[model samples]
Target: MTNMASYTDPTVKHDALLLFEAVDSNPNGDPDNAGKPRTDLETGHGLVSDASLKRKVRDVVQFQVDEGMLSPADRYQIFIRRGVSLNAQLEDAYGALGQATGKGAKADFVAKSAEYMVARYFDVRMFGAVMSTGNASAGKVTGPVTVGIARSQDPVLPIDMGITRTASTQEEKKDNASQMGNKSVVPFGLYVCRVHYQPTRNNQVSEEDLQVLWTSMANMFELTRSAARPDISVRNLFVFSHSTSLGNAPARKLFDSVTIAKVSDLDLPRTSTDYTVTPPAAKSLPDGVTLTTVV
Candidate 1:
């Protein structure tokens, strides 16, 4: 874990490019369409939402805390958590300070509460949040780290297959019977996601925070296992750190420098080995910028 104090710098900006692959797994499910894998209707390309990716990162951080890798008072709490009420958390925040958790709370108090939330929640500090619920409103913080939606390098084939279980859960089954179910999967896909860190946004994301973010992305799929997603892995992670907060080069240009292509002979690709990745040369990088690759 990186020292928490290291993230207080407010003038360091960063851009990252990630390449990952999924095999026979549903990376992101679409609730609008019966929990199927999300896809582009016209192009058939698989889609993984930025929220989904961020959730994975958050899960990793939470897991670290659970494993005692982080301390309780480390100010790395999770704001958007599962099985927890936002209002309840907000009330607790005010209660801790012996302040009224109501809409009529003083403006300065609200501002202070918001700062408290930022200091307590790692996600809030790095990704920002809208801490307004009921009588308690801590306002909003625009997180410094921004993640873009991930898309496959090529169009993916979504396959729906039927499954069955011989054992039934209910006592109503007198005899051994089978349970029927269906699941969706992508045969294979390599996805690309972009991440940006704006130092001027919150001045909360430090070099250590960025390292944790990278580690989270690199190992997210491996640690978060499920029947629906079992074979996803990170293939490449490219980071571009600029010396100045404003940055020296365009983000798109930096992204365009890296190229990924499938093997010319393979009609259908099933793994990361089937593709070739071309990263830009270090000398080609713009002045006042450094690149790091973690694969």
Candidate 2:
């Protein structure tokens, strides 16, 4: 169960590191590049967008709700759900207050509506959103959580393989052979992502919320399996907790404590054992800070 009371406290900061691997899968595809895996042109390393990771977290939340693990009144709704109209969702806020939404609405009404949105939607409270769209403008929130783009530690080679389907949908293809298609994948890759949570942004994130987020990150790959991304897994998760609201040490310094290197000079690594990761020592950690590994 989530501890709802901690959400009101405005003095908690967190930093986390997520290490994951993809085996013969496209972790994230670039629609602009013919659905190929996104990669850095200079470094040749694979890239996974923050949106992709956040979508996985959102899916986990939705799955939990669908399985009756959470209730609608628990204030854990998703605002950016598929096939749902944003205006319709916004209208519900006004409807709850027995009022209409428009340009002429008072400032207090807009503020209250924005607050209501932050309280009702988990994504809004976690990642924030620009609610200025649609008829009902409830303003905006900065949120507290921020996830950076994930990048492979070593260079990766993206391979595009030709695929074919035996069945055809059109009658014109009755005499035709299999339809040709393309599938892109990276032989193997180890990606690392940085995450930050600032309590002062909106003061809406609770201790339980952080716990849920950690769990979501650890299990997102398992829940988001598909042909494009079949063998994605989280290898490590490092969470850095600060005693103060701002932070006790520099994030970059803390991140530098975790180092990753290849075990051998293999042209292409296939397994996680091919790499070695060194996490920070507990005794050497900065004062007023602690580390926790979830995976």
- Tens digits of lDDT, candidate 2, 1-295: 1133232234667788999999999999999999899999998999999999999999898788778876554678889888999889888999987778777677888889999998889899899999878778888888888999999988899999999999886988777758899999999999999999888644766655676788888898999889999999999988888778888899999999998988989788898999998888888889977788778
| lDDT by candidate, in order shown | 0.83, 0.85
* Candidate 2 colliding pairs, count: 0
Residue 64 in candidate 1, Cα distance off native in Å: 0.9
Please name the candidate that would achieve the greatest TM-score relative to the true structure.
2
lDDT of 2 at 61: 84
Candidate 2 segments exceeding 4 Å error: 1-10, 71-73
lDDT of 1 by residue, 1-295 (tens): 1233222234767788999999999999999988899999999999999999999999998888778876553677888888999988888889877897677888888888888888889899889899876677787788888999999998998999999998887888948578889999999999999999887644655555666777787888878779999899898988777778898899998999998878787878888889999888889989977777766
TM-scores of the models, in the given order?
Answer: 0.93, 0.94
> What RMSD does each model have against the real structure?
2.9, 2.9
Q: What value does the lDDT take at residue 133 in candidate 2?
A: 83
Clashing residue pairs in candidate 2 are none
Deviation (Å) of 211 in candidate 1: 2.0
- Residue 96 lDDT (model 1): 77
